[model samples]
Target: MFRDSLEAGARAVAAHFDHVLSDAADLPVLHAMRYATTGGKGLRGWLVLEGARLHDVAPERALWPACAIEAIHAYSLVHDDLPCMDDDDLRRGLPTVHRKWDEATAVLAGDALQALGFEMVADPRCHPDPLVRADLTLSLARAAGARGMVLGQALDMAAERADAPLDLQQITALQAGKTGALIAWSAEAGARLAHADLAPLTAYAERLGLAFQIADDILDVEGDAETVGKAVGKDAGRGKATFVSLLGLEGAKARATSLVTEACDALSPYGHRADALREAARFVISRRN
Candidate 1:
């Protein structure tokens, strides 16, 4: 059921992208942006939708931030797969943006997607209240900017150049910013839209985000490139510190399980309404890609 919800949400967001991109003239960058945004689990966007549902927010309104988060996520992957970043050739079972096009196209596509993400929440379609739109825009900027995702990326690059690998605490902090920040924003977006309290979702997301990263680390150790839709074991190849490196496979898995439990528990206030989110937490650790 959760998988179904996730897929449906992904489709809805992709459709939104198609409609928005169609307004722009056809170009290589636009094509590259479409390519980059397509074919993924869409977990973050799904979280936004599900959280909005839980808050009684209308899908018409909820979709703005949902698609915004996905655009930002797509942009991150496009850049991450570039030669200067992960330097991968594949993503979601297709040639990565940089590999399919040129690196310059990839860079431009990424930049455009990032801008599009902000534009979604800032636009009047997102919410009628100017203050609400401003809040969403500000929070998105914080989540995607220097204080959040970018900070995590910088830390990651720094770790790569350092002699020693990151410790557990250090890695956890870095991921909280890099991966967790956007996730936090996605989960909390619904609450912001509804002007509801954010504590419950915030607690769920903190654990869920960390578990997601841990699962990714485990996947790198066990997954094949064909299934993962990207390079596998790159962290180990580069001697980078990961959950699997620091905690061992079994230990990392156990940690993920524990985090999922905590994340699910954080949803108790919502009763059965939160079941999908609980399942999402389980899916995080179980998914191979």
Candidate 2:
């Protein structure tokens, strides 16, 4: 059920991108924008739609923010995979944006996607209430900006340059910002749209995000380029600190399992209605890529 919903959400967001980019100028940058947004788990967008559903918000109203988060996410990946960043050559089983196109085009495409993300959430179509649109726009800006993902990225780069590796606490804090911020925003989007309390979904996403990163760390140790679709073992190669490195293989797995349990527990307020979310948490730990 969770897999089906995830795929459906991915398709929905892809269609939204297609429609929005349909009339865009036939430029390489525009093509890169579309290519960059294609194919992923679409977990962030799914969180938006599922959280909205849980809160009784209409899917039509939820989709704008869903696509908005995805655009923001794709932009992040494009930047992160640049030669100046992780220097990756592949993503989602294809060339990274910078590899497929020139770095200049990749940069422009990422910039466009980021702007598009803000535009989508700020549009009145996302919510009837002007205040709701304002709130989403502001929150998304923070999540994607210096205080959040960028901060985390900076920390990661600094760690790579430092003589000593980051400790567990520092890495956790960095991952919370780099990876968890957007996930938290995605999970709380439904409540934001519905003007409901954000506590439960926030808690769920906090744990889920950490679990998801831990799973990534584990996969970095255990996965291959063919299955993971990106470079694996980079952390180990770089001698960077990660959950797996600090906690040991079994310990990291145990910690991720514990986090998934906590994430599922946070959804108790929604009872069986949140089963898919619980499954999502579990799937984060179990995913091959």
Candidate 3:
């Protein structure tokens, strides 16, 4: 059931991407946008849909922010893979946007996708209330802007050139901004849509977000490039600090496990109704990619 919901959510968002991009002008940037958005787990989008489901928001209404988060996420990946950034040549087993197209095209594609994300949430179709739309747009800006994901990315790049690697506390704070910000927003979006309390989902996402990064750190150490779908062991190669670096491999796994448990506990308010989210928490730490 969990797998089914996740795959369905992915398809729904992918279809939304096509529907929205279809109205855009026929340009290379649009093509790059579509390419960058495809072929992923769609975990962030799924979180939006599921949180909406838990709050009784219709899937149709929920899809706006679901797809929006995915667009923003795709944009981050495209920009992160650029020559000036991580300089990766591959993503999801295919050429990175910059590698497949040119750097200029990749930049335009990522920028357009980010704009499209805000546009979708602000659209009347997302919510009839102007306040709801405004809220979603504002939160997304904070999550994706200088205060959030961008801050994290900047810290990561700085760490690479720093005289000393980031300590565990610094790494934790950085991941909260970088990888965890969007996920937190995605998880709590349903509550925002319903105008309900954000505390529950926010707590769940904090632990879940940290666990997700830990899992990625684990995969970097244990996974192969072919299996992980991008370069693996690059963190270690760069002598970067990660959960795995600060904690032993077993200790990192243990910490991730503990986080998943706390994440599941945060959903207790919803009882068995949140089983899929619980499963998602477990899946985060267990996935190979």
By lDDT, the best candidate is 3
- TM-score list, all predictions: 0.99, 0.99, 0.99
Q: Which ten residues in a row have the lowest lDDT in candidate 1?
A: 17-26
Q: Between candidates 1 and 3, which one is better according to lDDT?
A: 3
**Candidate 1 lDDT over residue span 215-238, tens digit each:** 999999999989988889899999
lDDT of 3 by residue, 124-202 (tens): 9999999999999999999999999999998888888899999999999999999999999999999999999999999
Off by more than 4 A, model 1: none
lDDT per residue as tens, model 2, 155-231: 98899999999899999999999999999999999999989999999999999999999999999999999999999
Candidate 2 total steric clashes: 0
Report the error of model 1 at residue 41, Å: 0.7
Tell me the alpha-carbon RMSD of every candidate: 0.7, 0.7, 0.7
